[model samples]
Target: MSDSSTVLKYTPAEMMIVVAARALAGVRTVFVGVGLPNIACNVARYTVAPDLELIYESGVYGAQPARQPLSIGDPTLVTGAISVTSMADLFGLYLQGGLVETALLGGAQIDRYGNLNTTVIGNYDNPKVRLPGSGGACEIAINAQRVFIIMHLKKRAFVEQLDFLTTPGHFHGGTSAQELGIASKGPQLMITDKALFDFENAEREMQLISLYPGVTLDDVVVEIGWQVRVAETLSETAPPTTDEIALVRGRLSSGKQSGGTGEA
Candidate 1:
C-alpha cells in the first residue's frame, strides 16, 4: 500500500497520468496519441512496462524518446526508435496489419457506448467550438487490438450522444464493431481523473469499475450525462505511489513539450 500522505502530494492530473500508465503495465506495444497518452506511455516505459514499444503516427516504431515529444512528428521520437518508416508503412503494416496491441486515445466528447467525437463541439458546418479533427485516431481506434481512452470526466464531454463520431467504439453496443468488421476490440478501458471505467458488460456500455481515492461514486455519476452502470464489486483505485508521482512529475518538469494544455 502507498502512504496516504505521499499520495496527497500530487495533483489530480498527475494521479490521472499514473493511473493511465499503470493500465499498460503488461502491454507490449502501444499506439500512443499525443498529450496525456504520450506522457502515460513514457511513464510506463520508466516504471512498470520497460519493454513496452511505443508507436507514433508520424512513422516512428519502438520509440524510446529521451524527452517528451511535442507531436507525433516531433524529431525526438526518431532519436532512438527501432525503425523510422514512412507514415504509410507504419499505418498499413503495423496498425492495419493488426500488430499493435493497444491504442491510447483522447476525445473532446464520448458517449455511453464509447463513441468519440473530436471533430467539433456543435454543428459541423457552423460549429460552436471547432476542434482539431482526427489525425490518425480513426484508423488507430479501428485497428488496434484494444483501445484505451483517457480524458477528463465532465458533464459536457460525457454526453448521451456525440456531435460527431470521429472514432467508432462499440457503435450501438453488443458486438456491433465485430459485426461491422471493425478489426479491433473497441474501447476496453476509460481512465478519467475521477474514476476508471471498463466495458465489461455484455452490452459494452461503460461501467464504473473503480473510483480515485478522493472521488465518490456520486461525484462521477453526476458528471456523466447518461445513467451509467456501476460494477457490483466497485473498488477504490490504488493511490499513486511515491515513486510513480515522482517519475511523472520529473518527466513533465523536464522541459519536454507536452502537446496538450497541461491536462496531464
Candidate 2:
C-alpha cells in the first residue's frame, strides 16, 4: 500500500492511546493502572517519549517493555521490569514519598468535580451493579503528583452524583484536592473517546480542551450528558500517523505471539 494511501485506522483502543500518550508525554513518571493507561504509557515510551518511567502499583518501578503488557499484574510486567520491590514499599515509600509524578486510572463514574466511583452503580444498600472494585486506584490517584482519568463520557457513566464515592474526590468545586489530603489532587485531564478536557484551577470542573481527531467540538457537547464548557481557543488533537500505526500494529502482533490478545 502506498504510504499516502494508508489512512491509519486507529481503533478505539488506539485512539485511547493517542490521547493518553499526549497526556503523558511531559510526565516523567506515572503510577499506571491496567487497561488503557498501560497501553498508552507503552505507546508513549515506544513512539514519542522514551524516557517515560512506569511505576506499577504491583511494585515494579522503572519497568519498560517492548510491547503492551497483557495486564497490570502480568508476570511480564515483573519479569523484565527493574527495581522489583515489595508491594508495601512500592506504595508506602515510593508513592507516599511523591516519587510518582503522574498517575493513570479508569473510573466507573466520574462527576464534574473530578471524583471517581468504581464501586457500585446503584444505591449503596441495594446496588444494581457491582464493578470490579478499586484495586490501587484510590491510593494512586491520591498520592501521585498529578492524576489522569480515562473514561468515555456517556449519560450512564457521567452522573450528577455518584451512588458511592469509591475514591475520594481530591478537589471539590473550589477546593484544592491536595490540601484536602486526598493526595494527587483532582484529575489533570479527562480523556474521553469524543474529546479531551482539563480542569480549571481547584474548581475541579472539566473544561473542553480539545477534540479528538475527526471529531467536532459540537459532537463532544452533544454526546456528553452534562453541560460541557469549551475552551475559547481549542486545538485538534493530532491523530496517529502512519508510522505510529505501523509501530503500534507491530507491537500488538508481537504481543499476540507472546501470548497476549492485545485486546486493549
Candidate 3:
C-alpha cells in the first residue's frame, strides 16, 4: 500500500494505464482488445473490479489469462477462460447481444468526434503507409454499451479529419452516432498521456476534463489538430499510487511498462 507521502517512480505509459484502468471500475463485463487495453483491463480486474469478466475478440469469454497475451491468437487467453467459442458466437452472442458493458479501442488516427482510422495513412488507392484494417474493432465500437479509447495524444494523431474512417465514434455530432446505427455510447472517455477527456456535451466531442499532474492546457492543445474544448472546471489527475504501479508492472514487465511516451 502506498502512503500519501510516497512518490513512486513510474513511466507515462504506466500512468496512462493506471488512469485507464480506473475508468472501468464498476463495469461487469469488458470486451478487451490487445496491447495497452489488455494490460489496463488486467490491472482493473485485480484492483477495482474484482469480478470483472474480460471478453476477447478471439472468442475467449471470461478470460483469466495466465500471463500477458501477445496477440488475439495467444494460447494463454484460452487456458483459463470460461468458454472458448467461435468468433462468430463471440460477436453475435456476447458483444452484439448487448451483454458487454465496455469496450476498449485504439487506432492510428482519431478525429475530434472520436472516429478512428486504422486503415491507411494516405489515400486508400495509393497509400503512404498501409495499416492493418479493422478486425473486430468496428463491431465493438458499434455494439458495446460504452466504448473507451486509449491512445497517446499527439498533434498528428488527434486530427481534424482522419485519413480514412475505419470505426465510427460520434460521426458528425449529436444524434449522428444513433443515425449511423452505432449502438454503443461511443467513446465516453479518452485517456491520453497528457490529459483525460469525456464526451458529455451535446456534440459528443472530446472535452478536456482533467490533466496529468505536471501537464498544462497548452501542452494538450498544441498536440491536438482541432481546437480543443475545455471543461468548465478542469481538474488535475493524481499520479499512480504505489499499489497501482505495482499491479501495472506485474502484468507489463520486460520494459513494456517503460516504453515510449507518445503515440508514435
Clashing pairs in 2: 142-183, 142-184, 170-177
Clashing pairs in 1: none
Q: TM-scores of all models?
A: 0.93, 0.87, 0.93
Which sections of candidate 2 miss by over 4 Å? Answer: 1-7, 256-264
The CA lDDT at 115 in model 2 is: 84
lDDT of 3: 0.85
* Candidate 3 lDDT, 1-264, residue by residue in tens: 345435588888888998999999978899887778888887787667867888998899888776678889988788557899999998998888999899989999999888999999999999999999999999999999989999999988999989999999998888898987778888999999889999999999999999998898899999999889998999999888877887777645432332221000
Query: What overall lDDT, based on C-alpha atoms, would model 2 receive against the true structure?
Result: 0.74
Candidate 2 least-lDDT 10 residues: 255-264
Q: 2 or 3, which is superior by lDDT?
A: 3
* Candidate 1 Cα outliers beyond 4 Å, as residue runs: 1-8, 255-264
Write the number of the candidate with greater lDDT, choosing between 1 and 3. 1
The full ranking of all candidates by lDDT, starting with the best, is 1, 3, 2
Poorly placed runs, candidate 3 (over 4 Å): 1-5, 251-264
TM-score of 2: 0.87
Q: Write the per-residue lDDT of candidate 2 for residues 31-69, one digit (tens) a residue.
A: 886666776776676555667788887789987654566
Candidate 3 to truth, TM = 0.93
